[model samples]
Target: MKYSFVIPCYRSEKTLGKVIDEIQAKMSEMNHQDYEIILINDCSPDNTWGTIRNLCSKNENIIGINHAKNFGQHAALMAGFHFVSGDIVICLDDDGQTPANEVDKLLAKVIDEDYDVAYAEYAHKQHSGFRNWGSHVNKVMTEVMLGKPKELYISSYFAAKRYIVDEMLNYKGAYPYVIGLVLRTTRNICNVEVNHRERTEGASGYNFKKLLGLWMNGFTSFSILPLRIASYGGSAIAFIGFIYALYVIIRKIVAPTEYLGWSSTMAVLLILGGLILLVLGLIGEYVGRIFISINNSPQYVIKNIINYDSVENKN
Candidate 1:
């Protein structure tokens, strides 16, 4: 089968060449040549593009796509997908953390198991504590939203059949979460345990702030639990206020002196005020997504294309 590997490169000059070499070595061992590696430079402010160009110059099968700007990982993946014309398309990070050797296992599951997509499941993660926690949160949210088997943890290292890639790319939204998109498109998914390694070169691009942003984006784009919780909370608060008003009325009528306390009044007012703001914020989150979508903003802008086929295709 023809395979197209899409690697999103961002300041990966140190490890990109080694990863490519590993992939090529493995492909040679398997006697597979109908393959191409698409390296997308996400406007890295480093020598990443130059290194990729040098590699491509020696190997025609290595295609280099330099984005006009840094479009983030998902956008870079989308851009790479457009150039892939293979039976299967696999996406992996430029970082060497995810071993290239395990890719064959994922491909086996996809081809032999008759699964549309086979994603790598890391048996052991090498991330920090907070990163692990964030991953767990994302997993729970995905399970609740997609109603899939919770065991299937979506890994960035996955092999997808060409049709699945096509369907995922068909989605025209600014906020593109690849796992979410895959779950929405197919249920014929499986996973294979893969070896995870520690990053040997640069620091991770995703920090605490980016992690929080991703969490918020996933919550707003995929689930309505937050909004529903806000609605329920507001209703419960309103009910409590009505009960308190009733108690005040009954006390005033039964014994007028029983209502001579400002503490309860102040407490009730504070609770109500907090609840109002919380509800408004929840609504605002949804509204904010809609506002961004309606503006027809490009998900990512390309400033230059190193070996891109067409200049007009630059967006």
Candidate 2:
């Protein structure tokens, strides 16, 4: 079966070549000569695009995609999905830590066991403390927001059947969250254990701001749980306010001279006012995304592409 490998590259000029070499070596070892590698440069502030061009020049199976701007990793993956022509599609990090040599383990779940998608579960991740913390938050977010199974761990290194990729391609939102799309698409997914390696070149591209943006995308794009939570919270607060008002009325009637404290009243007003603003902001976020999507904002604009035909990208 033909395999398509899609890698979203950022500042990986130092490690891209080695990652490709390992993939080639593994494919050779497996006797899977009918494979293609697609590298997407997410407008990295490095020579990543140049590296992609060089790789494409040496091998016809390697394709290079240059983004017009830095649209995060999920958008880059969405861009790569447009050009895939394989029975199975595998996605992994451009950094060398994803263990390309052990991809067959993920492939086995899809090829041999007939699963739609298989994720790589690292037994012991080699990321920094900050990245690990972000991953943990992401895991919990997915479980709560996307209805992802608690046992199924999601990572960058994974293999998906062509049909699953096609299903994911059908999403047209400006903010494309890959994990949310996959979870909503099907439930027949599993994870395979793989070894994680430490970074040899640059650090992770994700910082606090980017992580917050990713989490917002997860919350706003595929789920309305955030809105629901706001609604429930408003209801609960209203009930409490009603009970407190009744108690105040009964107490004032019992003793007409009793002073309803102004400080307590101001505190309640400030807290309720803040909550109102928070709920309004959440609603505004959903509306803002809808407006952007309605305007047909492109997910990722392709600046240049090598070894690919002139086909329209469904951004």
Candidate 3:
């Protein structure tokens, strides 16, 4: 079967060549001559695009795509999915942390077991503390919001069948969450344990703001649990306010001369006002995404492409 490797690169100029070389070596060992490598540069400020162009020039099987601006990793993956012509599409990081030599494990599961997708599960991840925490947050969010199975671990490195990729492309919304898209598509997914390596180069691309935005994307795009929680919270708060009003009336009737402190009134007002604003902001986020989708926003804009003579880009 033909294999397609889709890697979303950012600030990976130093290590991307090695990753590609490892993939080539692995394919050769497996006797997989029919394969393609798709490298997407997500507007990295470094010489990543230059490196991709160089690789494309050296190997006709390599395809290079340059984004106009930074669109995050998930957007880059969606962009790459459009040009996949292989039976099995593999997605992995640009960095060397995801071991390319162990890709056979993931591919074996998909090919032997007939699974729709197989995610690479690491025994001990080599990410920094902050990145690990971000990954933890993402794991919890997927389980709670996207109905992901608790036993199945999701990572950036995974192998998916062509049908699964095709079903994922049906999502035309502006915000695309890869985990949510996969979970919604099929439950016939498994995990393969693989060794994670330490980063020999730059740091991670995700910061606090980007991680928070990713969480919001997962929350708003795939589920309505947050909105339901907001509704329930409002009802509970209203009930408490009504009960407090009755208490105040009882106290007033029992002791007319007692002083009702302004502090308590202000405290209640502040709490209710804060909650109202929070719920409004949450609603605003959902509406804003809907508006952007209705306006037909492109997920990612491609500035240039190399070795795409036969394939037409649909983005």
Clashing pairs in 1: 68-302, 68-303, 68-304, 69-303
How many clashes does each candidate structure show, in the order listed?
4, 0, 0
Clashes of 1: 4
Per-residue alpha-carbon lDDT of candidate 1 for residues 1-315, written as tens digits (9 for 90 to 100): 789999999999999999999999989988898888899998999999999999888877778888877767887888888778789998998988888877889888988888999988888888778778878877887787656588787878999999998998886767777777788789899988988999889788877787777767666776788888887888888888899889888889999776468987788888888888888887988898888888976766755554445322321
**lDDT (10s digit) by residue, model 2, range 278-314:** 9999999999999999999999999998987522231
lDDT of 1: 0.82
* Model 3: residues with Cα > 4 Å off, grouped in runs: 310-315
Superposed model 1: Cα runs more than 4 Å off: 307-315
lDDT of 2: 0.94
**TM-score winner, 1 or 3:** 3
Tell me the spans in candidate 2 whose CA falls farther than 4 Å from its real position. 310-315
Write model 3 residue lDDT over 107-182, tens digit each, in one string.
9999999999999999999999999999999999999888898999999999999999999999998889999999
User: What are the Cα lDDT values of the candidates?
Assistant: 0.82, 0.94, 0.94
Model 1 lowest lDDT segment of ten: 306-315
